[model samples]
Target: MGAGQSKAESDEHFSEEVVNNLSDNLASPDTPPERQSSLDAHIRSRIQVELARLREEEEHVREEIERALEKENLDRERDMAGDETDSGVGQVKSTTALLGDVDELRKQVERFHSKKDDDDFVAARLKSEAVVQCYKNNPSTTLDCWKQVDEFKASVAHLEERYVESLR
Candidate 1:
């Protein structure tokens, strides 16, 4: 087997040398007609064989790449479909929970407003409204509303003191 392989390799090398020599000889004016035509045919056949092999290799690589891309696209589509179903369920649950939370907040705000009728809150609120009215009535004489502003500040301070004492 080794001897046969070496013989084949040597024959290939010899063929290349003959081809090179024949090409050079064919280019000169004194070449024989029969030998020139035969060398030219051999060289052309070798080139055609090599080109066919290269085209086959390129086609094989192209097929492999196309198959890989197709598999990737299928996997991506499957993942997206799964995510859509999961997200749809999650969104429904989250939306209902959010609505319940919003309703609780609205009830809290209503209760706070109802409690605003208490005596101290009403007094502070009334004083604040008076200060706003005074400022509106005397826009150019802002200093004139000092008495109303002072009364509002005193009411707010009293409310703060009561809140701190309740905390203690």
Candidate 2:
């Protein structure tokens, strides 16, 4: 701007010549030497701020890398253990799961008979999850919602008594 400066050159990396020229363009040449030195200091401070921001970014990236490496190591260890146990990495099948990998690896489950829904039905007065959720969601006044809870418990107990009588 002072002479033949373009927008592109102004955006280039800060150098002594560029910084002085930039300062001179912004301030009159009649500015005192002290003011010029202050401008230089301001430019240096800006550079330091940028450097500090870059260092912090680098530190964050390093922490992420370390976490990733740690996870990878743990995964490798699990894979090694699985290989020894003949499961192989992510292929560790549960004893109850449907696995066709025999040499008869799983000897316990002779059949996959699922239990009847009646077996899961409770006749006893038990707190259902929804009732517990009411207490959890409204911890300050659980006594306020006791009516609904009582109804639910009574309903379950009635169902359970019927189920027991049928069983007998």
Candidate 3:
């Protein structure tokens, strides 16, 4: 036969086989009334057992979910604590660096003040020598200049005392 004819014949055969199987199943004998009732009771008992097992499985799944959520919460709390600790450490490091900078600035100021004091001392000594030389040349004019020089020297001594006190 041609391929198209053979294919149509196979489709018809398959439909006939399905119809025969359905008719055979439907024509099977029915059970007696007492036997049918007993069979139904057995089926109901099995159904109750299956339902109990399914409920137990569901409860176990719920317990597992609760445990997983508790573990996740613990991990989140730990991560937050670690973050807080890291922030505290960063703050301490920043504070230490700032304090170090302040100490260096104080040292620089002290050095500047020391240099200024040395320059003032040298200038005062030179002025005192010049006044003495002028008195040796002109005694009357030198006398007034000498008095002014003495007053200036006393004020400088007072300023030096205050500077030393500040150092302490």
Candidate 4:
């Protein structure tokens, strides 16, 4: 206890001396050249020492962070391993059921796709989008979209004919 207290007191005194030395150097610019050089060298050495201490502290902190990260990773791996043996079994069963549902959905989707005429549907959708965009761009001159509206109507009619034929 006594040694620690004395060390703290000495550190405080050392810092005070450094501060006083800096102030004295700044306050007395006309100080003797030799004294000024000595002060400069002292301040530089103190700065280098402080920098080295900071670097050592930084390395220690980096090591601690790496250790913590590794611990967390190990914990995560353990949890993942535990999960695979427990809830994961139930999940696998549910996933298998879901896969069967997906296969049924795929068959239905294929049947629906067979009824669709892609070319006619794409033409109709494109024409519809063009008409809507024309109306949006020319809000005040809605008549300017007449050509687009006609094209959209024609494409939709063609698409409808294809759909009815597919139904037959």
Candidate 5:
């Protein structure tokens, strides 16, 4: 047989020997009835104590496991929220850049129209009107971008506050 199998067999034999010894001691006819009852009660009390200790240990382990799971869940949620905030900031940056480009384009178009003859006046006016309409449609877009950046900053501040509170 393998070494592992031999070791297992030995362990089983040891356990059986221990059980036999315990049974023989408990069943000895030389033991007085009152003494035997007292011994039994003492054994019962010891078993109850051991059981209570084991139950307490089990409860402690369960509480630790639950705390770890809750911490992991909170960390996952925090990471997801951070990713969403980053995506929002990226979008806001892109929109801000596009607005800047549009403003530059409008300026260039105006310069070109100013240098042109009266014949181009109608086309230049139409282009300028279109630009004006675009600005009018979303007058608060730039303001909104600024607000988003501010809000992002505020969120960081709030997180710091919460972290400090937790430490306390």
Candidate 6:
């Protein structure tokens, strides 16, 4: 194996030396016709081979860069997704708290309406009872019953004002 390696090394050196000599000769002003075409073909083939190799190297480098960029983009997306998930959890908590507050407010409103209805019923019943009592006490004149009716109206107005003030 060692002998073969040495032979290969010597062959490479010899080929390099031959190519250098040919290049130097061809570059001179006194170019020979017999060797001109052969040397020109050889030089053209060498340049084409080098250009192809360089192109392959460029493609390989481009592929490596693309892979690296793709991985970086994926990592960035994952980080953004994680942040969104964290914010989303916070939003859900806040929404839940708001909903609880709304429910409590709805219950309070329902209770207030219930109380208002009860007050109305009581006031109406009292007015009716007062009217009947006034009629029984003053059966002689309908004019005397105006006082009780006016008093009942004033009481109902006062109750309405109180209810409005309590809401405020």
Those runs of model 1 whose alpha carbons end farther than 4 Å from true positions after fitting are: 1-28, 89-168
Q: Which ranges of candidate 3 are over 4 A from the true structure?
A: 1-29, 89-168
Cα lDDT tens digits, model 5, 1-168, are 699999999999999999999999878778888988999999999999999999999999999999999999778766766787787853222345669999999997886656454433444455555555655666877444454445445555655665467459
Tens digits of per-residue lDDT for model 1, 2-116: 9999999999999999999999887879868997899999999999999999999999999999999989877876676677778785322234566999999999788667757
**Per-residue alpha-carbon lDDT of candidate 3 for residues 33-68, written as tens digits (9 for 90 to 100):** 898899999999999999999999999999999999
lDDT tens digits, residue span 47-144, model 2: 99999999999999999999999999778866766786785335655433435555344432332122123434432224466677788888999897
Residue ranges of candidate 4 with Cα displaced over 4 Å: 1-31, 87-125, 133-168
Q: Candidate 3, after superposition: displacement of residue 88 in Å?
A: 2.9
As for candidate 1, its clashing pairs are none
lDDT of each: 0.86, 0.69, 0.78, 0.85, 0.71, 0.83
What tens digits encode model 4's per-residue C-alpha lDDT throughout 61-155?
Answer: 99999999999977876676678768656333244566999998999789778645477777888899999999999999999999999999998
Predicted structure 2: lDDT: 0.69
Residue 69, candidate 3: C-alpha displacement in angstroms:
0.7
Clash total of candidate 4: 0
lDDT of 6 by residue, 5-103 (tens): 999999999999999999997788786776788999999999999999999999999999999999997787667667777878532223456699999
For candidate 4, the per-residue lDDT at 65 reads: 100
Better model by lDDT: candidate 4 vs candidate 5: 4
lDDT (0-100) at residue 153 of candidate 4? 94
Each model's TM-score?
0.36, 0.34, 0.36, 0.39, 0.36, 0.36
For candidate 4, the 10 contiguous residues with the lowest summed lDDT are 88-97
In what order do the candidates fall by lDDT, top score first?
1, 4, 6, 3, 5, 2
Model 2 pairs whose backbones collide: 123-160
